[model samples]
Target: MLNQFLDNISLPAATVTSATAEVQYWKEDLGGIGTVRAVNGVEVTTEAQGVISAIHFKSGQYVQKGDLLAEIFAEPEKAQLQVLDAELRLARRNYVRIKALLDRGVTTESDLDTARSTLDQVVANIEVQRARVDQRVIVAPFSGVLGIRQIDLGQNVSPGEAVVSLQQLDPIFVDFSLPEKNYATVKSGLPVILITDAFPGNSYRGKITAVDPQVDSASRNFLIQATLKNPKQHLRPGMFAQVSVQIDAQRKVLVIPRTALIFAPYGVAVFVLEPDENGDQMIAAKRFVKTGEERGDLVEITQGLLEGDIVASSGLLKLRNGESAIINNQNQPPENANPKPGNS
Candidate 1:
């Protein structure tokens, strides 16, 4: 009789947190590693070879378009310009005197013409001299933040030598590549998100601005460009980034919290709660599941789960198949499909 009583003994209910399987729209995420690029970036170079005389801006300085950046030694050119100016003034006076003489019949028209030609020649020479002087000055090509000073004052720089780098940071661009198979799905106006290790836990939102018409021959990947607002100017060119884009139409799928699933060598399973034969207690029943894609804290259930099914989200290890479970959700926080743990 004691052995029979022992066989009929019942175990207490196990406490577990529960989550409900929900039906929601799901989209496919396509992603690739990319590099951040400035919308407008260049190495500010010099056109004239000469020794630097003055550097008007500091390193990493913000400048407007046409702002003076540096100047090359041009004392000789300035002196030459002054001499040309004096010669032009003299030629103008001679031209005026010859014209008056011609009008009074004191000189021939040929003399007046010769004086006029001299005045025109001097004016042209002065203009050429001014242009020569302008070549020695270096100005910003566009409004941007300047990089370090490449050439010091009094240092000689060759023509086409980089003086500094200028980059426009607002509305930056990010270049990425995707497999050519996805070319038809990607185009201008598609939304993209970018994440970088430089700024942890932060993401940038933007849209596709351009897509290469042809795929790369070697890699079979097509190039894609995206534009993002960078008002703080934090994103720098050449920074490594991970970019993702959602493609295809949204479809309805059953979503559940990842904690609810139990993974074994055979397959995945979940503890689904059901009303016991007594009708007053709940029982945990083991059910095999077929999972699809996972995004953030949520997992997609392709099969074995129905909408509004209550499953064990926590305390899975503490419960056995057919074990009784106590519903204790007071400690279980709400489930979020896309959870930002840092914010929490």
Candidate 2:
């Protein structure tokens, strides 16, 4: 009965059509979720140790560079400055008097020189004291939003102590990693599409700004940073994100429905259909092909096939090379006939 069925069965002929060739660049996605962080974040601190005499700005306030955020107790330094001013005035008076006396030959040039030196030393001391007093106050280093205040008014803070944190939020960074195998494909300035669970239906576009030169030994992945412009400050730091880097678009390539290729022990092969003499259609030949990569329902044919070759999309297993076939071009299969698991 099986032999009779095989004898009655006839192979179907596929119409020959020219296909445009494309060169597709494919990449494997290594899953890693990262947050949107500022490219520059720093804590502003006082340069000199002093008690916070006054806090000028509240927590979470936006501040500009050189804006006064806090002021330390500078009363002692003010008092010292006043004393130095008095000393400088007295030294200048003595120097003037000595210069006049020396010019009139009433005193030695040595006395005039000593008085000038005294005035210079007192002026230098005043400048030194002024610098020391200026160090008591803390100011914002850049224009950014200030974090929560770490010290309260009247609280003593040591040098290098954190007064508040500042972060530039206008432009943020989406940092992620890709496997070492994909390192060659990722380059600076490539466009990246960013998606986050925090904000659904909204996608932020960015470009690759940096790529780590060395691969991580432990994870065997290379680090990449993409800069995303956040004008509205909607995206915050530590927000989980999904990033897609577009390497390049595939131009033109000879592709077939992925289901058309039959995998066998010998090699991957596809049945091509052609018309024989006397207007009879048949599976003209079985050609072994080398497939490069697959995308969606299409597979690229790198070799063993021409542009106009037609291949069987269904019922390929029962057909053999040179078997007689009937031409059935109608009832075409769907565009994406070969559906894989988990692929929509």
Q: How many clashing pairs in candidate 2? A: 5
Kindly report which residue pairs in candidate 1 clash with one another. none
Candidate 1: residue 171 lDDT (0-100): 89
- Model 2 agreement with the true structure over 42-77: per-residue lDDT tens digits: 988888888899989988888888899999999999
Runs in model 2 deviating more than 4 A are: 1-35, 181-184, 217-220, 251-344
TM-scores of the models, in the order given: 0.72, 0.63
Candidate 1 per-residue lDDT over residues 244-334, each given as its tens digit: 9867578788988888999999999999998888888789999999999887788999999999999999988888788789999998855
